[model samples]
Target: MEMEKAREALMVEEEASELVSRLDVRPHRAGRDASFYEGFALRGIRVDHIQPGLLTCSFKVPPRLTDSSGNLSPGAIANLVDEVGSAALHADGHHMKVSVDMSISYMSTAKVEDELEIISRVLGHKGGYSGTYVLLSNKTTGQIVAEGRHSLFGKLKSKI
Candidate 1:
């Protein structure tokens, strides 16, 4: 039974990867660099607006991301928090950073096919550590689904 489940999971992952490849909606970065958060593209998350110290993204909750109870899973919410939060670091001229800690508060649940807006902002930076805050909100109904805080520590890469 476990082996069967693993095989099924692998098959689902392959299918999602194929769909991502066909979508042609990945974020465009110079030199065609592979984003560290490639799974975001696979899951149909798109950067709606980005600027220094802030990033706004939109996503549709796909059925595959839901728990058996038909609501978005905690893991999926956490993934969004982390990915969106990391993107905010770029606003501070950081090319990369390693997560040091993270926390999330789940305020509400999102159902499959629901549209969500994720807003992330750089809160502070000191001594090679940066803090970010992210909020997930329902686009249509304007309800907050989750909020997250992330701390990261790493060297900020030089732009030039």
Candidate 2:
């Protein structure tokens, strides 16, 4: 049943990617302002979908972001996973969310040339805390490279 849910989530992400491609607006973190992903050049990490508690993101792994093993660096994967998971909390609407805790487990290695799909869903949200689950997979093989759980604290930001 978990596998089925994951598969369904992937399908949703694919569709959302197509739709997002048509949008005129880009994410606030798409460029140099993306300090969280500064270690590696994050080409693009798009929020594919956000429905209620679910969120999905697609990413491209650049060769320059690899390690000596010719695989994507664990640090890079961890950063991406955290960004995607936190971004899920904001989705296309909510904002001013900060990650308070992030735990990642690497299951496998992903080659630098691999395109990755990251799917995140809110497990629970209450008061000031939000819990999220994220899965990172190689797009071609559907092999999961890493999974993460994040706890977020959110507050409304005052507009200047």
Q: Which candidate number would show the highest TM-score if scored against the true structure? A: 1
Give Cα-based local distance difference scores for all models: 0.87, 0.77
lDDT of 1 by residue, 108-145 (tens): 99999999999999999998899999999999999999
After superposition, candidate 1 runs with Cα above 4 Å error: 1-42, 157-160
Strongest candidate by lDDT = 1
lDDT, candidate 2, 18-111, per-residue tens: 8668754434565556443344356677667777667877877787678888998888887786777777777635666778988999999988
User: What are the clashing pairs of model 1?
Assistant: none
Off by over 4 Å in 2: 1-40, 156-160
